[model samples]
Target: MKSKNYDYYLIILTSLILLAIGLVCIYGIIYYNFLAVKPEWSSLYAEYIEIMNSYLYPFLVLLLISLGLCIPKRLLGQDILIKSSALILGATLVLTVIFNLEAGLGFILAVMIGIQSMVLIMTFRKSRAVRFEKHGYVVRLGSSLLHLGLVVLIFNFVTLRESPSHILIFWTGTLLITAGTIFALYPDRITRLWYTEQ
Candidate 1:
């Protein structure tokens, strides 16, 4: 019996579920605050809800890009997917750097961009590997890039906060520990073994 080609189905189902969850989270956050106040004095609620909705925009973009990554069955080759994903990741990284000037909002946006880029890159690599029937160096580089991006994200969150010196010290330690784990696990354990010769 032949195995089923369910990759596209899986991707679509997963993306839809994720999108729904994100939308629900945004709605709940806005509605929870909306319900806690009286209508007469809650005119600012509209602005608050809009601001909350803005946060879900990145997640929506991510969901769409993930769907785009599932195009191998429709396309003739994997090259298109890999190149397009890399281009998207590069463009998003540039935008992330440009938006790095602010604190909480900027940090969240930057991290979201980084995470989306990682997902795109990984999907691209996975498709390319399936086409070529061999593992390559791109996956290793993608893993490293993801780990570095996560460390930067953590640092961005820490430095954005206005806290006492003691808290800063604690955050510094936390960042170090997290970065160390990424370094040890990403190249040596997690992604490295995934691409090892079978």
Candidate 2:
């Protein structure tokens, strides 16, 4: 039987979901920072922080679910899946230690990274091996770009509070996200010449 074509819709949907979440998080962080400076907003800030903290776990869960859906069907084999999962977990652990991440939030972040990494690995493997149809190539490239953008945004989010170069990081993340969006939405127009050869 011929292999099933990739689900471009699912990839785009998942990327949008992730981008929405990242934007929400960035907004929350920036708003919180702004509120911290004003004495009158103390009560409001506290409430906002409480609400964000309370919903964090559920949000992480949602992110994981969306990311899980982005994984290609080709990577569903038992051995490859296990290996990919292990690799993700190992990398997450190492990063957590190196960064001195907090216990609770760090664990959640690690889990999120692990899940994203698994999907990314699967996507990369499939895109490399398969000679995708035109739409398939676009979907693969778009999804990969979006994933890369999300990773940058996540890193920015994590360090937003503590980093001295906050403005620089913020701009970097924004640029990445913009580029990803462009790539995802206009893959055909953007790569028509190069992709024709493939």
Q: Which pairs clash inside model 1?
A: none
In angstroms, the error of model 2 at 171 is: 2.4
Residue-level lDDT tens digits of model 1 in 1-198: 111334555456756868786776978777766665866547666766565555654554454345334423223245666576556556655655676323333444454445445543654556443331113444434433443444444444435446456456456546645644564445446456566854
The TM-score values for the models, in the order shown, are: 0.36, 0.52
In model 1, which regions exceed 4 Å deviation? 1-13, 16-41, 71-73, 96-198
Residue 20's lDDT in candidate 2: 69
On the 0 to 100 scale, the lDDT of residue 196 in model 1 is 81
Give the per-residue lDDT digits (tens) of candidate 2, residues 31-125.
78888888789678778876675445445434544443333233354356446545654564465467643333345444554544555565556
Q: Candidate 2 — what's its lDDT?
A: 0.56
Instruction: Give me the runs in candidate 2 sitting further than 4 Å from their true place.
Output: 1-41, 68-138, 193-198
Q: Which candidate number would show the highest lDDT if scored against the true structure?
A: 2
